[model samples]
Target: MPRFTSRPLAAAVLAGILTPAIIAPHAAAVDYGMDPDVVQNPADTPNRPETSGSGPSMLTQGSSDGTVTEGLINDYRPQTVNPMFPEGRDHLPTADIDMDPEVLARLAEYAKVDGDRIRQINAYSPSMGRTIPLVWIVPQDLSEPRPIVYALGGGDGGQGRDNWITRSDMVDFYSEKNIHVILPMLGAYSYYSDWLEENPDQGGKQMWETFLTHELPGPLEAELGADGTRSLIGMSMSGTTALLYATHQPGFYDSVASLSGCGDTNSWLGRRGVASTIYNGNGTPEMMWGAPNSDYSRYQDAVINAGRLAEQPNLYVYAASGLPGDLDFLGPNAPADDGAWDDRRGPGFYIEAASNLCAHRLKQATDARGIDTVYYDFATTGTHSWDAWNNALREFWPIQARGFGIDGGSVTPGLDGEEAPWVGSSDSSRYTDLFGPSSEIYGGSTAPALSSRLDDPSLSSQSSVPDGSSDSSGSSGSSGSSD
Candidate 1:
């Protein structure tokens, strides 16, 4: 037999040269052990969480004022908002998306969704100047509109091969939950930022920040039955993206989270990660954010924006210690000389180590500002893998749920172990007072009406008129609108 027969055999099988009868015997002999039912669901694993530390799961740090919590958490035992469902009712996936038929007609489908759980929809992004793929975990059973939780993928924007869906069980996990989970396969290595110029390697103009915050939401929300509230959760590469997006567009996301991501893009390690992630994908930092140490660079750093994040009411930040955990494939059972450890596991350890530092820095920055909305965790043992990320998600859904305007989805510790009581829509974080009516931004389902700050006794009497002066509050506030 030739040295490599797998490819030829696979090709022959696809070409119909090898019928089922010819392949069945060989296939049956091979115990790939990949049955979805038998194989452990990443969403369901790490169940035996035995943290010896007595500290809170929510990263709490001492501040001049008092205690401070770190990024994303689930403290919901807040007994107010109506639950989206009964304790046990599971909502079936349904939708009334009103995307433009012509535009929808233009986008080509990359791959069909799986398990009747996820729906793959394509859209032409005006910002990217190309079609984009969106995996929408539509809310289970629609009545009143629900919030949208944008779960972004990690790694260089992924070419349909590497992503949350492909590498993790989070898709099925979120699908079963109530909130709408929209994962846009975007900005592979650009940090999901608006690039000054396009990198030919990146294909074209990468106006992701604008695309997500301004362009996509306008039309996408218009067609959907979404509540005005939206949240973002991202891992690794996009983790920083989520932080910056929520930071820059304050009052846009009800809650935001970053898992195993660096917050200080201006820091030496943070910049190194950014440069490597971008360049590895055949991109350059100049095209993405301009020259190093530029004002624009500082503006992009989440640490520098901590004060802005401080204003955010709900946030979650998490990173593992980088030591191998139960889910790491190259753990104790794998041979040391296999080269897999050096290639993957080794890099994972250091990557997570770097992330741990970033997470601490973010906590420090937010803490210094007296932020109290974070639910953070710095795992004692975990790798830069989905097992850990899923753990974070299971734990953080409460924050997301709180912001979504409802409650009930969260992982609770039990005598046996930890389990997700519910994962779908009872979604929302505590609604922060956002400016402007959502209608002006999302032509789709409108979010809650904006609360006028002018109503507050704190404001001094001023002309609600546009005095050709630099002050914008007077003019915009009077219109029941905002910038």
Candidate 2:
């Protein structure tokens, strides 16, 4: 595992250098029109500054000034008691019953699709005292239990019950292979983690990690015929969450795939980007993990914890440079011939470029640890949009199918000949290239010890081959609401 040996930097640097770029007021209308199915028009929903803001702080004036005062900074300090969890509950709690039948019945009304049978499970979360909507797509055949493919939607704050059916052909693809699909309706900017406090923007307790990993499986297995084995694939914000979850809970997923995700949450730039994203979504950073450079932030840093991912049986990491490609104009949301690319295509491209840089950092960490199961696909040209993600999902399906022990029919061409792109070594120089030599980003010239255990030659020699059995299960449960 890679390491960071330098002393932590002052929080003032983050406030001084990072906040301005993140919170600058918007000059134009924020576009949620990229995926109408996943995001509603900002005009359709009333502007609620108390909860979900109008738009990104940098893009809207009414949003909160993205500043962290000294008092709020202190809140990041470790608390004597975690407010989100129940008192005296040191471990994860379990669900006592299956999903409420009434909720399922309500969801059943919308499950009538052409090809596959879609069902809704009102997964109960003890931490939040509410049930989260989980949409499942089960194949028509009931011959046996099927391995599950957990697909997470990007940050859009709307109910994503129809994302798989509407956004892409995931339903048809998975159904044909007899694989079950689970799409949790995570609110737009949840980031899918156990927050330090209840989110003001999205409301409800943000205990997504607990729910996705611990609570939802039993009901899925018992009621939905889902075998214990699973693969997790997420794009954009959820992409980052997927990687973090996999790292935090090793062996929890047979395979993990990240599409255009920012994985390096500990770096100065990375931290600022995520802080901006949270604040723009009308969420407070202190509520999610704490102040910048907090211990909880470090704990949630996927790059810092990439060593755990090295132990996974399979991994797929992808990102595109912020440049237009031949395929960019082929999707439903293709750029218009007009100059809308200046606003629509340009910003997403750069965001994805930064995310790709983070993915590069993850690649360096995984490479340094000598993990060989990783399949990294870095394109030279592309933008951050659903089309790219949809294509990535289709391209990576065969690899995911193999990991889940399913034979995905008719392998997509050019997949076998694809080479994992290399992004230099995991060294101080590489860090400089990505974020410059400023102490604000690098902290020091040397990398700190991310995980000493990963450096052990004996441990590195152990096979990361996952147990192909479908009986394994993990534990916890929690819930949250969308903005």
Candidate 3:
């Protein structure tokens, strides 16, 4: 994924906003237009400070006559946590229960650091009529209401295991940021969408849309101290779902980030992506959304429903062109790449290339309609793996910090250094014409490894295609409702 910046000239744009930087569907203002960055606005400033104050540093006299007023001062600092954020994950359809063995083993890896802050929370989603396991991360310092950042993994949605966390440093990084993070252990193979029908093979009615937007947040926010703000981020397969979720509900998530995620899923390539994701999960499209180009299937497309995002002028839209960047091969935090079909590096090249194509289409669609809130991180060079995504989380955080009331100043800007993935320079339109719009595989520098892997006919025939489709430029698909 590219660094989080403007759709084009991302570095220069961020340099301007660091120099600076969501939609709402469900309605009423969530943040009340409160500026969360600065502790105080300081309406007035003097060239120099007086050596001596009137009394114990309580002076607010800027009048020409110099009269001091003590009793009229009101500090806007948070006295207690936001009524929404402090509640913890609230009343549930089911009580918190023991985590699955696999999940527990995963949690064991982080026990030494802040494992105690994480608790296993099992909540029932009546929409799906099943138990959804969630990893609830309560911030260590609850002095103020914190924004809840809901992160979803791509491809099989982690197959019931925490996907990206196990592959990248996401869990560790967010753990120290004092944000309440919720990772749901559901939607394996599904796109985390509310399907029309359950797959007969990998069958289970999935109301992920309702479960996440309606059922899950209410009780969690009520009891967990939500601060009336949320940020939903997704990668790979779930990336499309994340973008769709923002359009699904207005004013719900103030911030939305799609790292190397596709926002257009109505094209032939898009349909294939959905199909392949289901196939890997051992399901079929007939059960999920019926035939391709069906009326119901179009409703699930992100670009088709993007106009809904324009309703939210303040929405933070972040996406990336899945080209190779500094973090891919040399990433210090990513798991080792063995160059196998399943390894993060090898297939990631083409998969991310596909996502890169999908991203450009969405960028044009959003731009054509004047949807300017988008921050498209078009990496000049990245793979479609955890390494790119982990960097994206850190990069997107600072931009979101000010709005979410966290001090964005604490998050450092990623420079040209290899370690800094958030480097400002970004553009989303890199490969829209590379080897024709129909081609999804383009090797920037990561081509060698992919070529070597594909050289072996045995491995080449056995490798599971990443998106299972080309990241082509055909924007035509079934019509959808943006509302």
Candidate 4:
């Protein structure tokens, strides 16, 4: 009967005095909904796709030479043989590890009932000065060593142990299809790039490239019992890094995936505003690249450099956004506070580099290439959170699976059902070479709450959400990826 004027005080008093027997279970936090309707597994999607709007239209703009650059056309880049590895990485050692009992047990405990096998191990990168911890996931039944798909983490770098191997939507997708997955843990702040400056005795100048491309493959090959031919998939920051590595060393990866990882170091350092953080607080973009404002300065913009990503045989590229229209959380109004420019507010603001201008240029370059690239724009609603990425993992796995010569039908709802829009593949306006025999773009009436997990700027992590809630919408129709 006493006045309960203060909420916090009342909560504390009740919590302290109330025992389990006295307090009732709170129903406010519980969400009760009808059982979800299950559809056919997406991997089993039928091929009878609805075709609309002229089949596979060419996005090619004219060049003076008059050769059509649309469709499957031959493209090339002047290969620069790393003088360091002239004979190739034949000298690199083979990776061998007996899985620790603890890691093995955990892997088995969380073993996806869907027949996914997960392995946790470490690879030392002498160039990067640390042991690159990795988690490898394979389907339980596959005897033959399959092509590896390398997935890079987004934060300062995450421990690959329990990160996603045991529980990622993408890995699950691949595992179900029998594709091998390798997740590596680079230094958190490293952004998978070689430090321009040295870190102790480790190699510095883009040494990650050497470790990933030249050094680790031998051991990985030996461990997997196959030659180290693999694919590259990156999310957010790693996404850009994956593309850079693939473009620099074209033949290593058969396919490339960039999930919410558009733009480059310029975008991260310049527009994303982490330049000084990347350079160890000793350098700014202006100092590192001569003049920050100069377009021709050192370290050319990655988006602009994308034009050079031409010419990889059997190259499959995929770029996607959880939400379109400048990512909502990015750009000038990101933090909405002056304190956002804490470290060095110099020329390396990555947010600036990730601008509409940057986004437009990147789209243009990718589109110019006649590669089979797919730019999925889930612009209706969502954020740059892991939940959105998880859904992307669903959509992306199907797309990537398709690239691996694995064919299937639509797994999610809407695209295959009666209300579906243009099916059987078309080019997104954002990119050129990205194509599919069929594609679905949709929008969600409600953005999933999972995106908020990555809402924290201090700890660059993404959130998780339920599947099929995030929507992808172009101007025409909306679709969901529940499968």
* Candidate with best lDDT: 2
Q: After superposition, how far is residue 111 of candidate 1 from its true place, in Å?
A: 5.7
Q: Give candidate 1's whole-model lDDT.
A: 0.48
Question: How do all models score by TM-score?
Answer: 0.61, 0.70, 0.63, 0.52
lDDT of each structure? 0.48, 0.53, 0.47, 0.36
Judge candidate 4 at residue 271 and give its lDDT: 26
- Judging by lDDT, tell me the better candidate of 1 and 3: 1
lDDT tens string, model 3, 75-135? 1111112122235233434222223212333233322113466654555666556556566
The numbered model that scores best in TM-score is: 2
State the TM-score for model 3.
0.63
What RMSD does model 1 have?
19.6
Residue 144 CA error for candidate 2 (Å)?
A: 0.7
Task: Give candidate 4 misplaced runs (Cα > 4 Å).
Answer: 1-116, 160-167, 200-206, 226-229, 267-301, 313-359, 368-378, 408-483
Name the 10 consecutive residues with the lowest summed lDDT in model 3.
12-21
lDDT of 4: 0.36
Instruction: Give lDDT for model 2.
Output: 0.53
Tens digit of per-residue lDDT, candidate 2, span 1-483: 112111111000000000000000111212222133434322122344543322233322322434332221211111222333435333767543333233322233333322236655445567756545566677767788888888876664324332445546676787777888877653456687888888644546888777777776665667767777789987777778877877777677888888777766655455555665665456665678775556676667766555567677667776766566655566665656555455335555556667766776666555544454566666666676655666778667767877778775543332233332233322334444423321111222112223333244542212221122111101000000111
TM-score quality measure for candidate 2: 0.70
Clash count list over all predictions: 29, 14, 30, 41
